[model samples]
Target: MPLVTSRRFFELGDTVWARWYSARKETWELGTIKEKVGSKMYKIFIIKYEATCIRHIDQLLKFTGNDNSLKINNTDNVESRNFQSLPLLPSMPVNAPLSEPSVSNLRSSTIVEQPVNTDAIDHGNGEEWGDYSAQDSVGDSTKIPEASDSPEASENGVEQP
Candidate 1:
């Protein structure tokens, strides 16, 4: 059989590192193959940029978790890029049921009531203000004065009809 130049390499939902070239720089960003546009072309959803774009087979690299060199460092400065080689594994599975904390584990404490020192407060003026209770707040919301239907009272003798 002869060598096939055009072939489908990536499948839908396959994680890949896509090569993105801009006017200023060229960087490889992690993404997943969303759709197969052509035999060798595919539409991928970029994870870093949160965008979808069409890419050729040459622009795509399958992320099989083996090629450590090809993996993007998620940082601009390569010298200062410090990250663990392996991903952190959780002690327990996320869907696992959580155990309730027992009453013995909880600490019991007595709430001490402190006396208020009103003398420390500086009342701007020598006059002492009366305590405003719930009743005082309710009484403050009085009916607003509306314009009277009667003719306007004027200091001058000139009256409006």
Candidate 2:
């Protein structure tokens, strides 16, 4: 019976061969593990490329040297080390309620709104002006004057009130 040993994870700072793809060809590059970014994932610094990249455990192969000190002895009971899974992004409240800022809260203390010069504002075309609450009625100048007020109305024998 042959014994099979599996190296499930690599430690930070361990030298490993990282898989690289170039022009449809798969190549292996030497890299040093720099960080454990996620479950079964690591950040490695590729020596040849002088660049750091994230890779999964399946993409990395541990480098064992002739020095006996660097070799990890395989054991039948060997288990993979448990690593804490770091969050890639800050956790946000899943069901946080969104709201519009109140008018008072939105107003800035530095912004002082100047009083509008309502009296100096021209309503245009010498027309009668009224307060903001003004509305159109039968006699209101702002309303289109009824045809009864026209000089042509007198010619038509329509009595002017």
Q: Write the per-residue lDDT of candidate 2 for residues 1-161, one digit (tens) a residue.
A: 88997558988888876776544445566568999999889999876567899998877766654322232333311122111111122542121112322355443358679998787565884443443323432445555667888889989999877
Report the CA-based lDDT of candidate 1 relative to the real structure.
Answer: 0.60
**TM-score winner among the candidates?**
1
**How far off is residue 22 in model 2, in Å?**
2.0
Q: How far in Å is the alpha carbon of 53 misplaced in model 1?
A: 1.0
Quote the lDDT for 105 in model 2.
Answer: 43
Q: What is the lDDT of residue 66 in candidate 1?
A: 44
Clashing pairs in 1: none
Query: Residue by residue across 1-161, what tens digits does model 1's lDDT show?
Result: 98867553987988776766543445565678999998889999876566898999977766655434433445533333222222223752222112323456567689999997776454675344345444555566775443442345344344544
Model 2 segments beyond 4 Å from truth?
A: 1-7, 66-161
